[model samples]
Target: MTTQQLEVNFSELINKPKATLAGLAGAKRILLRRRDAEDLVITTAARVEQDAQVMSAGTRMFVALVRHDTAARSLLLEIIPEAFPWVRFLSEESVRAFAAELAEVLPAAESLGNMSAVATTIAAWQHTAEVHSDPELLAALTTDRGEDYGPVPEPGVTG
Candidate 1:
């Protein structure tokens, strides 16, 4: 499978009352806006799958590093309960710091500064994680189901 990266503006995608989304007419898309509606749209399902693998691999490495590395994770989690109010914030900050450290050795984090506001950025991250981490949450968010999830059972729970 092959994938192509397309640079597009949100204004262009949402130009009409129709969906610019994937279907018999188009390919899958990931909308990312960094500035002034500047967006990167991944317009192929195959590409999406490939990108997902790349992202997942990167995420796993990051988790492994922070989860296993003592000193690095400690500095960020010092206040534990204070500095990090949300998991997303912690992840973003960890990535930020890691990128900064990476920059010392190699130029990086060049675009991190252009990221959206902390609150909104963290919110989106948390929202996506929530949807992926829990099907019920995704269902509830996507479609209103009057049922409460009962604290969302722990992942992989066994009776």
Candidate 2:
């Protein structure tokens, strides 16, 4: 049986702190809904630590599996194309390289709790596959232009 998550409006939380907190008695966490802002989650410190520990252990196990088991690595490669159809855009060698780099980055990112880095890594590889899939773009990129290029503008800056 699935237990419903306790939900309390943000205004109710501020107006009736005791009652809002009391909802945690029957739930592991309470989702604080906000009409005008991002929603918030209220959970105990113990729950947070427990989740971190589980994630750490799971990361370690996955890293070990990929590193030591060829079958596991092969399975990952086999499923990767199915999981992300964009991977098919990449050559076999690029796909293998992407998998290796992902395996290396994923454990480190999880260890540091930096999921964004993992997302960026995947996006970077996907974009590379996209470029490789386009013959004209790939040719343009691979062709060296001897002309001097102007300096790149800083990110998020506009003229």
lDDT, candidate 1, 1-159, per-residue tens: 423333445664567315445421443454545466455654557765686566556655655566578775765455443533444433556545533343232212212322134345446645655565676766677896577756766789964
How well does candidate 2 score on lDDT at residue 72?
Answer: 99
Models 1 onward score TM values of 0.29, 0.72
Stretch of 10 with least lDDT, candidate 2? 1-10
- Per-residue C-alpha lDDT of model 2 across residues 12-118, encoded as one tens digit per residue: 99999999998887888999999999999998899889988897798789889999999999998999998779999898898899889888888888878777787
**Native RMSD of candidate 1 (Å):** 15.4
**Which candidate leads in TM-score?**
2
- What is candidate 1's local distance difference test score? 0.50
Assess the local accuracy of residue 110 in candidate 1 as a C-alpha lDDT between 0 and 100: 18
Task: Count residue pairs with overlapping backbones in model 2.
Answer: 0
Pick out the ten consecutive residues of candidate 1 with the lowest summed lDDT. Answer: 106-115
